[model samples]
Target: MARAQREIGAALLEVTRHADVPSEALRDDGLIEAIPELAALGETPQDPHWHPEGDVLVHSLWAADLAASHALEHDLDADRRQLLVTASLFHDVGKPQTTRRMNGRISSHGHAERGGEVFRAMGRRLALPRPLVDAVAAIVETHMAHLSVRGDPSPRAVRRLQHRLAAAGTSLDDWGIVVRCDGEARGPAARPDASQPWRRVAARLQ
Candidate 1:
């Protein structure tokens, strides 16, 4: 097997074997294992406009921390909240396998696609329910949409996402929360204020 697939396969086996935690806890651990790939893609120093470090892992974890914390404050149901936290944590797990060099810096240009594949494989290895695994994979694939939205999001993009949301149902909100958290954890200057967006979305759903 390829090294990346091997690593993910091993990790999934380990998680499944030692999944002694509550279902929720196991979800958290699974997410942690999945996100290092985001760093591999150079989504680290999340504030791409101004970042000092080349460590994608550090950047990814910081975003995860910020994202999870933000998700905890809302008036979400238990499962949905867990979904948010889990998605935020695993949003970039495919990074380590997709590392590359660009413009005198490191980046993982195709990390999202790579990570999605890794996530799908890992989900199968772990025997995750198809619905749950699919949700996680979709979140990984679409995590970068927010960056585009920050610029000039095309109607096509929004419609595409809306279609995805319609199909995924409640879980789609989890991806949205992850996206918001990603923006906030990027950097001091670039972090968008998540409170309002969180409230708007949360209220609309309720």
Candidate 2:
């Protein structure tokens, strides 16, 4: 494993294991400075209607924490677990750039694809393995595909997403995990209603 990968994996695992709290390792290692997108999240505001929790940074870590718990429940292997954790961390990297107030609501339109592009560059800069980087970026880019399914519910759409996942060396299972975690991070007020249907479709494809 790349050193950058191991360091991030360990830091995220610690955060995920400890109820999403910022671990000492992360602070001491200067991960925030190393990953500026994370620092930017602190300044980005989220609409309370959706994110009753707080800023994008808070939501990202919270989601990663949830993902870690789910990974344990499912007994995911280290690689899959790491991928989920990493994707969760990078999931909203574009929010700082894409977030905007529209109709009295904060929206991050196209943030997923924007985030994916940011991660691809960041991953390369950090010297992360090419396949791992691409896979994580793929998951981030397509994370919102499930929401479309909630509205459309088309098998063709599902198949198209599946092909994309395969091309990136990931699977529907991995994509679904990130989506569910991201949706649930809003806390109970904004429950993952849409995610449930998406999960059903993803489950069939998996």
Candidate 3:
């Protein structure tokens, strides 16, 4: 991780610890039961840059909601829906661990990597299914790939992603939906372009 991100992550962790905020408190099951206002925590409200809908915290909630709604429409099996919802909710949990303010442009920079680590720790603590844990990790790792490639991912880029998923024994379809959920929830009119190159890449796998 970058130096600035590392420092910020430490500081955020310090804040969480100092506040005696349990990670479990933010977890789906725990939050649903313990903190009725859990959904309202850590959110950044509307801004001109990046999040037009609000902060990363709000965007994460939107992603989780999108995943839930889409899973219901597809009539996903209970296990699949569980995986999708859990992954969506927890994918960016590491952002709180590593908040960076560069030139007043707040960015988590390397939070994807740190966030994946956070998810892994959370999964182990919760005793999540091994495959589900693995799937979530992959999704977290590649969460920004679509954005990084903009709208024109090369065939080579697609192939590389496919190869990595295959090696991890994960499904592009599962992760693709997670990515779509994220894109659709990021801001006002936040729907992802249906014709995005990466969506085509996912279709080829289907």
Candidate 4:
């Protein structure tokens, strides 16, 4: 069982590394089939007001493309770029399990943390390096933190986030990129100041 899982992970890593990985390839190459976890995103419902893109899977694909495009624009090193893309693809992996209709709306509270766990487990099963796994998990867990910064925007909150990234073996710059990509994928409802809050935090950290 362990060996089979490792093989599956390796295949996923290869797919993620492909520079031309189309959103359609997610289904075409049987990646979603190999990794059943991905299919869950399709069934997961998201609040239409916030996720005009439709479903978690659609948002994730957009996020991955945006992250890859940003990585290329910024000339991020290959490994760092791969990490960003991979994290983007899996960032909402937990929403399917956590989705609930509450107060006449949908909410996936704690989905970020749950997604982090899913990312970590998949990374481990794929036999990815421990540091890489930690970095991706940190990105997944904190993906929502940037949005929250719009409310707080405190220097202390920024510093705490910086510390959290540091402890997770990733840098603020990398996390910022991922967060920005996530914001870009939010379609019409995306906050115009999406990147500003994190930029403020990063500036204070520096």
Tens digits of per-residue lDDT for model 3 on 150-170? Answer: 666877777777777666556
lDDT comparison, 1 vs 2, better candidate:
2
Ranking by lDDT: 4, 2, 3, 1
lDDT of 4 by residue, 12-120 (tens): 6666666655366566767776676788898888999999889998888888887777777777777887788888888899898799999999999999999989878
Better of 1 and 3 by TM-score: 3
Clashes of each: 10, 0, 1, 0
TM-score of every candidate = 0.63, 0.83, 0.72, 0.89
Residue 119 in model 1: lDDT: 72
Q: How accurate is candidate 2 locally (lDDT)?
A: 0.76
Ranking by TM-score: 4, 2, 3, 1
Candidate-wise lDDT, in order: 0.55, 0.76, 0.61, 0.78
| Superposed Cα deviation of residue 196, candidate 1 (Å) | 9.2
Give the best candidate by lDDT: 4
RMSD of each: 6.6, 4.0, 9.4, 2.4
Residue 178 of candidate 1: its Cα lDDT? Answer: 71
